[model samples]
Target: MQDDALFPLLSALAAVYAAEPREEAGRTARHLLEAGPSHLGAAHANDAILAEMAAALAASDHPAVQAILAGAHLLPWGDNPVAAQAAAAGDIYVVCTLMGPDGPIPSDDFRMGLFWQRPGTYYALHSHDADETYVIVAGDAEWTAGDDTRLRGPGEAIHHPSLMPHAFRAGPQGLLALWRWSGDVNTHSYRMLPDPRAVAAA
Candidate 1:
């Protein structure tokens, strides 16, 4: 049952990556195409935000965004494995890995997935060993990397080098993005840094 939706979802994502100008995007596209359809069962959680994410994606004009929304119901959504503490802080987000080591389509060296965050949520500063890139498929966000910050909307891309501190606050409509990780793609090194606002208050 999941394979029915997974195939089209992955195919659509491949098309999205193939159209990107980055070499990494091209490689990700090839990986997706080679993986084919596979099922990992439903990993769904945080049901409340799923509907909001779907609504935001549905409002987007991007084709990739529309494709994601169409297959969202079948995707294996799950919580953040690396930062469990974030949930306690009311910073909730979900992930659906289409291709990666733990995903239905296994790839040790890279990971490609979708990420959705609730509206007005702030994901505090964090860093990891993996080199990551996120392309906004729907909604908007204020992304911060080190000292730089920018308001990013649909179709924009943000890159974070290995171990570089980064964070983001979702816009009123929330955020829906396609993300990929490569180079030291291990969650073992993932760590959340102290929130600057808290530090300032102290």
Candidate 2:
């Protein structure tokens, strides 16, 4: 939470990364990143630099940007999970995991790697601090706002600027998407957040 304490975590990780063989560390980082920042889900973004990254993501075209622009742009990583999932899913899988979105912290901005959905599922209603953009990479998706609906396919996108009410459901064939948190997601808010029925009914 505090700048003074942040370095210790980084230092611990750095120490581990330095001591491990390069190949092993590389493998480890890949695993961590793939896990979608859920571990640091609410922690990492607390940093000033991370906060800026969120904003950069908010204002840029992802998977196709050159550098940080308007202080809020980000390009997709080549070995990014979407590429990997698309490769394995034949253009129809949920295509893999949710984006490793940067987390909470006012002074910071963030980006979401990519968040897709499996066929026939509702992502539930959610919202965050940074404005965001979702680009459909493959297949189709349906985003909902109250009673309104927007359907999209590859190359199509939806933008939700901070606090706007929204929700998504993948198409019958699933969805592949890229996302952006157009500003600091220092305070992500999910509307009607997920809550499964605790009772199992027959």
Candidate 3:
């Protein structure tokens, strides 16, 4: 029953990503959709912020957002491995990998996923070998890449090249975004850089 519900939601999500004008993001999502799901294990993770995420999604009119809201409970939600290792208060967000090497849909060199962060939470600077793009599905955030920062809301897309440092601070309503990874997709190269706040406090 769950599998029946999940695939359509994933297809809706792929459509959402494919609609992006950015070449890399659109191509990666379409490729994964064509490859299809492997129907892997039913893994789940616990996080306090998921409720807030769902509430935010409920306010969105986008079809993809509605699709995720309908099937969010069926997704294999989990803590980000790098966030688990580096976060000060343990896991601050939840992720659902719909496609990747380890996700239900298998892809060797790319990944597609959803991410939700708690309200007003700050994800410090981090970098990894894979190139990444995040498409905001609901809520808002202040995103920083190197010396620049911008307030991004729903339907906005942010791209980060391999190893380019980036960070996010979720807005009052928190954040819910779809993200994709390409190039070197291995998480082993992920690193948490020095928090700028800590550096400033020193």
lDDT tens readout by residue for model 3, 57-76:
87776668867776777767
What lDDT is obtained when candidate 3 is compared to the true structure? 0.76
Question: Which 10-residue span in candidate 2 carries the lowest summed lDDT?
Answer: 67-76
Backbone Cα, N, C clashes tallied per candidate: 0, 13, 0
Query: Each model's C-alpha lDDT?
Result: 0.78, 0.42, 0.76
**Stretches of candidate 1 above 4 Å error?**
1-4, 43-46, 83-91, 198-202
The per-residue C-alpha lDDT of model 2 at residue 14 equals 30
Return the top candidate by lDDT.
1
TM-score of each model, paired residue for residue: 0.88, 0.43, 0.87
lDDT of 1 by residue, 22-135 (tens): 788898898887877654566564567678988898779877776676678776677344545444444456777777777667788788788887887787788989989898
Q: How close to the true structure is residue 53 of candidate 3, measured as C-alpha lDDT?
A: 77
Candidate 1 contains a number of clashing pairs equal to 0
